[model samples]
Target: MQMMEYYFGLISVVAQSSENVLFLVKPILPIMLRIIAPVLGVVVIAAFAGNVMQVGLRFSTKPIQPDFSKINPNPVRFITKMLFSRQSVMNLGKSVFKIATISVVAFFLVKKDLFWIMKTMDMGVLQAFQLCLLLAFKLIMVVSGLLLILAIPDYFFQRREHTESLKMTRQELKEERKLLEGDPLLRARMRERQKSYAKRRMIQEVPKADVVITNPVHFAVALKYEPLRMGAPECVAKGQDLIAQRIKKIAEENDVSVVENKPLARELYKRVDIGDEVPEDLFTAVAEIIAFVYKLKQKEAVNV
Candidate 1:
């Protein structure tokens, strides 16, 4: 065979002159590199592309992070899982099927070219190498095509299995919703209780007011003032509609003066809030009302 003759010639050259050995090897080195480089490049590219196809271009370092759970405490359970787990079983089945199919295909392919393969024994080294390279290229192409067909179904099956595994029961869904959003009924009840407490506090403030100003029917603003203790007249309580009616009733029961000033009541209700000082712009109007209330109280005291 040409291969045998080539090796024998190299041996003779090595024996004749060790310096000539480099000359013979120099040409072969480039040929070997040329033959191997494309296959290696293809393998590296295919591995990168396969990962990109599966999970896109996203990158994560989580897989390399130290995990206590990975340290199995039970050897028997770990061994059983490795041997009989669904993923492991599927992997083993796929490997066996691939090997059987490729072997059968390779066997048939070689048998078809048996005569041509045998004739390579009489051919030159380069011719025989070319023939083998062509056969290998065909074999790889067939194997890659077959695997591609198998991968389509495998992809869908894995996706369906993942979806099934992630499904939650009604109780689990409810718990997850509660964890994320809180209980709506409990929130509503708390809001109702808060409103009731605020109303009670506002009613209490009405009795402490020196005078309650009313818009006759719709609005009420209760103000308190003490020249020695406070800076200016402050709205102690304020409300509209039913709350305004309640404020008037509380003022009457407590003997606090109730002054009907439609414009003052509406302005105070709009511009000021409970516990806030009355604005300076309405000082003249408020002072007039306060003096009038004080005169009426003085007359009542004198009568008593």
Candidate 2:
């Protein structure tokens, strides 16, 4: 049997060793995924929130794969960027400020407990040291306050870094968008159809407006009044740019009054909604417009 084992020694395997276990660990990619999963999840959620809060997301691929080949390695750039610029200066200032504050607090606390310290000294050296510990506690409290202040900038910088790191290259952005949106031509055509439909609806509604108020040529707000439903006139529509000019043209074609009360027009557009009552603040302003429209209607009735 011994001779057989020597010849077939390969048939027996030694138990797994730490080195073997570590080798197994190194090859397993999922182990690294499991470790970083929580961090990735946090980053995704934070990036989403940051996108919403910041400039409403103009997606770019520039941040994702930035070129650092031309990175400045000059002494000024290195010193300023590495740890001595705006953020670092703020940090250093904060640290010195906190130390000073804590020191002042500790000094006051030590003086306040001086009587206790004296009494404790008469009792024993240990009790006197305990009295001095009161100052330490006050210092801790002041230091904690300073830390809260310091954490504000740290949180902002973390979000800023996250934003910078997420930047992508132009090609990366196009590829990612292609993957997500599919057939760019078809997507653009769909958008044009939607815009055309909205335009048709706007054209149809412009004729029914009681008054079309214009900022001469920039802004247009259309109002409609229903005595049974609305306590006062409500804005049916408000548009700017090409839509505003279109509204004015349609108002002229439909014989609807194109009022020039810029302030009243602005107020109606700002404070009122479609099919809602005009605000109390605008009551006087809108009442005057209504009176003018009514008189114009009375005169037209006589002419007919």
Per TM-score, the best of the predicted structures is 1
Off by over 4 Å in 2: 1-188, 270-277
User: Where in model 1 is the C-alpha error above 4 Å?
Assistant: 1-130, 138-181
Model 2 residue pairs with clashes = 61-168, 61-169, 62-168, 62-169, 63-167, 63-168, 64-167, 64-168
C-alpha root-mean-square deviation, each candidate: 10.6, 21.9
Clash count for each candidate, listed in order shown: 0, 8
In order, the Cα lDDT scores of the candidates are 0.87, 0.73
Candidate maximizing lDDT:
1
Model 1 lDDT, full chain set = 0.87
TM-score of each: 0.52, 0.38
lDDT of 2 at 45: 92
Candidate 1 residues 1-304, lDDT tens each?
Answer: 4654586467765755556677677767877788789989998998889768765797889999999989999999999999999988988998898789888988998898888899899987667778887888888898889888878877777778768778998999999988897898887898999989998998999888889999979999999999898888999899999999999999999999999989989999999987899899997789889889999999999999
